[model samples]
Target: MRAKKIYWWLVFSLSALPSLYFGLIYFLNPRQLGIDPVEVLLAESGQWAFRFLLITLLCSPLRRLKLRFLSRYRRMLGLFSFYYASLHAVIYVVAWIELDWPIFIQDLVSRPFIYVGMFAWLVLLVLAATSPKAVVRALKKRWVILHRLIYVAALAVMVHLWMQTRGAIGEVLLYGCVLFLLLAERLYRAVPLLNHQSVGKSANN
Candidate 1:
């Protein structure tokens, strides 16, 4: 039991380190961020948010490969994704828009990427809110359906990134491929014939 507690502590600490480093750099050495510090922060935090979200999606595939221990860390990874996403939103509001409601509203209307990104963030907010044991227990079967929105969130994020890219689409394409594979795996498992074949192979192994 103590070991389990230690494991979670380690997971949380490691997950928090990047945000801490980013925060320190942003606050202590704004010069290091170059002329477009706000843009830099927005990009970095937004990238990490998507990265963590992908990692959260990967937990299921890893578990299927017998790395069941990863399940314990999944919630932390998801929550960290939400944390970075919230930071990304905050930086946009404060640094980019300077808390100007009129500008924010205009951007929401004019920028489809911002609208999509905000929708993804809202989904993450809902997932994070219901991640607790009590909430999951209360929701029961409905929880599974609700959490499936993660895939929608992932799709929205991909669109958001694609729309935001100014030039090279290499990174966007890479993430798109990864998300594709993850979704494919889920679909593979959902099909009974394929799932049975996979189970047979696993048992034979």
Candidate 2:
């Protein structure tokens, strides 16, 4: 039990390394991030958000592949995903936009990608808000239905990423492929059960 606790702490610390690394760079040697540190921060945070989200999505498939212990850390991974997403949003608003209401309004009107990214972040916000054990217990079966919105969030994020650039299709495609495989696994598992349910219903009829 003590060993398990230590392992959990280790996993938690490792999971936080990305943010810590960025934080230290920003504080210690902001020049390393280039001249536009805010833009660098925004880009890195957004990328890590998707990376962590993809990793969180992988937990279920990994468990199915016999690495069941990963299931225990799924919630932690998901929260980390939300953490990076929130960080991205905060940096964009606080530093990038500098709370410039007029500019923000102009961007909202002009940039469709911003709309998509905001929607994804809002979904993440909902998921994070409902992530607590007490809330999960209170929500009961509804929790599963609500959490499925993570897929929508992931899809929106992909759209947001794709919209951001027309030049580099490679990075966008990589993230898209990872999300596709993760989603495909869920659909693969669900189809058989859905077919079985249909057969059972027909037999009962």
Clashes of each: 0, 0
Q: Cα RMSD to native, each candidate?
A: 3.9, 4.1
Which residue runs of candidate 2 sit more than 4 Å off their true CA positions?
197-205
TM-score of 1: 0.91
Lowest summed lDDT across 10 adjacent residues in model 2 is found at: 196-205
Among residues 3 or more apart in sequence or in different chains, the pairs in candidate 1 whose N, CA or C atoms overlap within 3 Å are none
The deviation in Å at residue 29 for candidate 2 is 1.7
Q: Write the per-residue lDDT of candidate 2 for residues 1-205, one digit (tens) a residue.
A: 9988987898799988988998899999998989988789999999999998998888878877888776788889899999999999999989998999898888878888998999999999999999999998999777877898999999999999999887879999899899998988878877886767553322100
The local distance difference test score of each candidate is: 0.88, 0.88
